[model samples]
Target: MRSLGVAVAYPDPGVADELVHAVEAEADLYLALDPARAAVVLAGEEALSTLGEHPADAAVVGVAADRDAIAVVARAALRCGAHEIVLWPQDRAMLRSIVRDAATRARIGAGRAEGRIVAVAGARGGVGTTTVAAMLARAVAESVVVDLDPVGAGLSGFLSDGAEPTLAAVVAAVDDLDPAALSAAMAGHAAGRAICAEPREAAPTKQQAARMLALLRATVPVAVIDAGRAADDAAMAAISLADQTICVCTPDVASIRGARALIAAAGRGFPVVLNRSARMRLSAKDVARVVGAPPVAVIPDDPAIRRAGEAGRLPSRGAARRAIERLAGLILAEASDGS
Candidate 1:
């Protein structure tokens, strides 16, 4: 096992000495010269001001003197974004345990490859962006779908009954975000997990959106973001981070025009998926010509898919399901090749 680095930031020399002694007592733990390089940072109340300078992935353990000091410092720690609060002397064992766990997490994160992110955006509303995102997530192994759309009924309404600690909550804690915090915010679904947006909640800022996506990339094998139409800052943020952006649109004049504009704005060719294909006279080639790229997948207008969606489930077997599965395979292949 690799030794874990511990960094201490306490205003009082006596308290700092105690912290250093506790860390040195463990054979696996060693003092880190740079706080940013450490797996865990032990900070006293006054030292909490330096929290912003450390890496967000570092575990922050706030140290307080006693029960009385803990009460005062705990509240301050929460505001300053500490992950945990430890009482000096009394919680020495707990501190050691926290350091060990943090070390394990840091090692795992450093060893594993970062995940692929796919952003699904629609040419316009009602073009099946959410459906494509949800189905793609289901087809991909060890995947999660994130609902970044704020206007339409969230992706959770289509997949599950939406869980607590929504996207809004996650964005609010982006400054101190961790894999554990994000995992708790996800809702369970037969397809996979989802971080659904709360209805009518304010959109995430660009910084918050970027931070959330970064954490997701570090945590999951793959993440599919339902970016709606890619109109707002949050949607653009997802697109900016995505390894691939799938543009979904129907084979119609208006929809094709919208898709062309989106493709042009992207300044690069993106794979387009023709949703509800063969329902109109426009063929895949016609739509592809207008969109400046070939249709990667054509999902037929399947009644089974509609029926399954109405019941908040995906079609077990159908042409549409097979097409989505192929798309998922392509995404996985591209991600692997990139790696």
Candidate 2:
């Protein structure tokens, strides 16, 4: 919500009213003369060069005076990530219309906004990947946890309140997406978080999964994909699009082998999670040795985790609660640093 910097090189006062009103409507843009705190710059010949400019962080809204060619502005806008351009209109009504459209595009990139993708996949089935995913989602703020299970054992029953969640309905509706469609696909869990739980009775094609993940990142600031047990080609594609991957490993040798193969094969990084710590007959260090990195986190063995998943909330309070909080903080800190 930083203020937008607007430099009007239009050289005419005739269309000033219309242009000013247009930027006012959009909350994303703040019209401030101070160069230090601008989200966007309306650069023209005057002070533009003096501002020590060459694509500083702000998005640029280029305006040409008395020239009502928006199509020209649109091309330049896309290139520089400039949101919009308002041509000075002698007609007040036309100026208002142009500014409104430009404001809409400004919402796409904002510094305070967080853009992230974290995928959770188990070494194999029944190792608590889904439970950990729900926990991770619960820990983050303003984020969505999607159970994109292509094999489609829907995540609905895990919630304490039996709300049947299906992502298929939303995914099926979108071919090309923007922010608006993303908002529609998400539903609130009673536990005060959002989840996309869709039944995948028929397996989703690799192409479908790839497209879904692409569109999800296009709009939301943070996206958490929960890949239960096996990671199909589609799941692997999801991992490739991730900022990081959390591989849920138990202390069994077979699980460690599977996790190692997954890490070696993936395009990005793997952050190991040793779930259910106490029951593991093998040591975490031994397991980490196989996976190639020291385990980044270990969620201790706790029955409350099952209760957390069943209630559709992460284990907010537990014997191992500190570990969960630490993992959440690590992810958040990584995301913030990325910002």
Candidate 3:
């Protein structure tokens, strides 16, 4: 593990020294005199106001002396943009854990500027969200497809030819989530691809879901996640952490209505992809108007898709593949623009 650069600020030198002694093995301790250079800022309740005054880019962790004082300090810390608040002595382990996470985030964030995460979620079941996600993963170099759909066919089965450890093992090691751990958990597939999807038995917790995405993003250039129908906590976590969330829907009234509701609930700027079926009557324009955002990409009904699925092969070339590639380009463009 890389050493975390932590800035310690407290009213008493003895306390700061004690903190340094405790974390010195894991972190590179620094005085909070120059907060701008620090990855994480640790401040006593009294010194919390100083953090606000400086307004550094580092994540702030406020320390309170005891449980009784923590509530007041926590509110103040939050108001001052503190990432977390810790009760000193009582919550030492928790404090260290938070600080370590903050430091890891800071380190990974600085290393990569284009490791974008694109999550695909279905407005309703059977909307081809997993297909789109797998296609997008194929379009991107050094990409991984993470399946958060507990009930759906695993991405490994749909996309990969080889088998290895699944996401079940990864979630089991959530506390040690990193590039190496994720790589070990990932299953090898054809065409130089990797995927992290396991059986439903090893579903991750909400925090684990978020951590999985964060750590995966640190290693790969693009992470294409099939978030399924958002019926579970892990799916919800994937949606929340995604850089770009693509809601896939058919052009039917029910699908459009569900997509619209999902888009509204997902907040502004999340794009929708219209997957046209053979029995579709509603136009792309109608779908867009209902969803409140112009369609980013459209996939028309293609028998090639069905044929490929039946043959247990991904669509290599066809209208469907072309459409998915176009959608991938649009997602890449958006990621570039945001970066």
TM-score to true structure, per model: 0.70, 0.71, 0.66
Mind giving the per-residue lDDT tens digits that candidate 1 earns over 1-339?
357789999888998999999899998889997999988888888777768898877767888887788877887788876767888888888777777555435534454326678999999888889888989999987788988887764576764654452787788888886676777777786468988886767788778888788777766788999999888898888887788998999978888888888878777778899998875468799986787668999898778888988888888899999999999999898887983
- Cα-based lDDT for every prediction: 0.81, 0.62, 0.73
Q: RMSD to native for every prediction? A: 6.8, 5.9, 9.2
Ranking by TM-score: 2, 1, 3
lDDT of 2 by residue, 52-161 (tens): 55335454566655355556655655555555555554434454334333333343333223357888888877777776776676677666777766464545545445
Whole-structure CA lDDT of model 1 = 0.81
On lDDT, the candidate that comes out on top is 1
The best candidate in terms of TM-score: 2
TM-score of 1: 0.70
Candidate 3 stretches greater than 4 Å from native = 1-106, 109-114, 190-192, 277-280
The residue ranges of model 1 lying beyond 4 angstroms of the native Cα positions read 1-113, 159-165
lDDT score at residue 35, model 2, on the 0-100 scale: 43
lDDT (0-100) at residue 145 of candidate 2?
76
